[model samples]
Target chain A: MSRAALLVLADGRFPAGGHAHSGGAEAAVKAGRVSGAGSLEEFCRGRLHTAGLVAASLAAGAVLGLDPVELDGAADARTPSPALRTAARRLGRQLMRAARATWPSAELDALAREFPKGAHQPVVLGLAARAAGLGAEDAAYCAVYESVSGPASATVRLLSLDPFDATGVLARLAPDLDRVAHQAVEAARCALVNGVDALPAASAPLLEISAEVHAAWPVRLFAS
Target chain B: MHLDHNHTHDGPPAVSADAHRPDGRRRALRIGLGGPVGSGKTATVAALCKALRDELSLAVVTNDIYTREDAEFLLREAVLPPERITAVETGACPHTAIRDDISANLEAVEDLEDEIGPLDLILVESGGDNLTATFSKGLVDAQIFVIDVAGGDDIPRKGGPGVTTADLLVVNKTDLAPHVGSDLGRMAADAKAQRAELPVVFQSLRAEGGVKDVAEWVRGQLAAWVA
Candidate 1:
């Protein structure tokens, strides 16, 4: 079941449209904010902490059978960028289609019906994960992995970097994925017990600015 | 603050029981066109609107990294009602908006659907990108990857995921094949070799009056959806 869930979530063909984006790596690369492998790692690490963490936590909540509506609202409040929020919700809708097709659960169907005015990806993914009968750890792992893989894959295409080198970067980040997943499960438990409003708020201003600037570029390689 | 005596219901009673449902009926099929810069993504979109607009309730969302150039082009051509076409300024990496985040595009699509009411199709045109660029599955129900003959017949041979895996691959500007010394047949063969059974349409938007073959395929997808 976990394997099937992973395959559905990780498959590039699933139709959530992750291929067009580079997380924020494209703008970071263009601005010289990320130049070499070291900077790439740092950028990924930062994302893993903020957006990645939030997504993982939401996914965990979904795995734990918490309310997706509340999780989606929390995700919206956490993601400050309108562009990012928009992207997440689009992905959420797509993910919903795929998840419902694969799992066919009442929880997923209900969440899809109740998806508020602006639902994003992580919340939907979490609910999908639960519907698939996966646990919080599994959902967290998928959320973090998807967030990082997008940029890692984009860097290879954008820079013409050796595929082996890109894989190496991903391999190095693997241990952190485990750590982040654990952290996410814990966070999710806290949020479920006390509500997402009780969780600490963290924002990444530079990344937000980069997304805005990247949006304004006359030409670009990635979407966001 | 004292409550008004005329108010029968006490201050905004909890949740509005009649809050309109967010998810309405199934939306029109959304198709995204993405590929390298100058690969004729806009021309393909315009041709699609011309070909399919009358048959389908259609709208377009064009992503321009900075400018609303593609939307402007569609408007200039009057492909659809001005209200049906929208532009998203992706601000940085066009891919991120289409791939990584996708919120703005989602809202644009939803807004279009809400305003138009029961539209049959929405086309999202991605900003120009490299060989690997592709639509997030979330963004479109199906996607078309456009590569012009001038970009080289070799592009198909290069074999990126977009070339090998997009639901449809459109080799545009086939009319320019002779001028550019490109082998349209060989390009088609190469694409088929890479994609196995997936379909490929070689189009000259200039000659064919806007991708009739691809437009037809889109019609088929919509037909299947209804079925």
Candidate 2:
């Protein structure tokens, strides 16, 4: 497996429709919880442990050659907010297009045929990693990093937070990101044996609740 | 790297820049309108909608910088039914959405066609940004770059991708040119010099039949697309 494949998949500019989404940072920012870099760190930390963990585990499972349709169902069941579900599917469709174009494979084609509208994004991301010849840990790292990167970048746009500050926040979270990625790969290994039930079910009530509120906003920068 | 487009569903997978839809029919001609802030891209879209609604089936996809303002404006004007207008949130990177990562805009246009849709044309309106903003060929068959006299007459002289390479360069608000002390002749001349033989239309929506030139140009584009 090529290490460069991980870099390509995890790059912030992968053009996978992640730019339009803020991963709940918009909602949290508007709710006055993620105003400053300090608070931004806290927000990323909470999201990293919950939503990020779940997404990473899913990606890892998919990379391990688990059934994508089952993983998609697991993704849907894990997602509580209708808005987030829609976003996940939309992102999935977008990632699917980019992935299919970049790395043409039978698995991607079959997935595209099955879920033309979309499956869950993390599933597609993991499969994209698999097609790119990346390992399960690579897929987990991509998912977990994306979980935080989306919000950190969005915060710079939303609160006019300094880019340096945002970068620093990410820097502080690096060790934790590594740990979460490892844990996610471990969970994927467990799920490979015990079924999808072995995957993590960490959930952030605030992120889910805020996503619903953000979706109803008549005016907002990020989609959600 | 497969330049050979396979429209057949049984063939190898293809995505991005495909001209055919999933149903084996051709997709509607997509024209992108991009310009700077307050350059009348939205207003031009509304006028185009009003002008061509009788003869053609049209839909609109608007990229709003921070809100659904452009899409709502089209709906408020009753230019098209609510179902035909889709707004894509740009996450403050309007240029990125249209030119770099066109997935969302493509999705919006595809969904519009799927919902209300054997349409003749789809106008993709980019959020007002800088002169550098332009649409990717993957997103639109043709593109119209709009600029107003108020922004500066030198916009033509200082041409960007939007001004120099657009299929059509529209010097909008020509009616305001005199009021703003702009040289219409110079703007036209600069545009001609920048793009030899490429079309440029000067329009002012306030004038009766002002969008006629643009409408006619759009008609020509649609005709050529079908041909």
Q: Pick the candidate with the highest TM-score.
A: 2
- The native-contact fraction of candidate 1 is 0.06
Pairs with steric clashes in candidate 2: none
What lDDT score goes with residue B43 in model 2? Answer: 93
- Per-candidate TM-scores read 0.67, 0.96
lDDT by residue (tens digit), candidate 2, A1-224: 99887888888988888999999999998889999999999999999999999999999999998899999999999999999999999999999988998888789988988898888999998899989999899999999899999999999999999999999999999999999999999999999999998899999998998899999999998888
- Put down candidate 2 lDDT per residue, B123-158, tens digits, no spaces: 999999898998998899999999999999999999
lDDT of each: 0.77, 0.91
Per-residue lDDT for B1-227 in model 1, tens only? Answer: 12234433222111111112134245567888999999899988988888887777889999986577888999999999999999875644677667765656776787787677778788999989888888877667788999999998899999997899899998988889999899988998899899999999988777756577998899898887656
Top model number, lDDT: 2
Clashes of 1: 35
TM-score, predicted candidate 1 vs. hidden true structure:
0.67
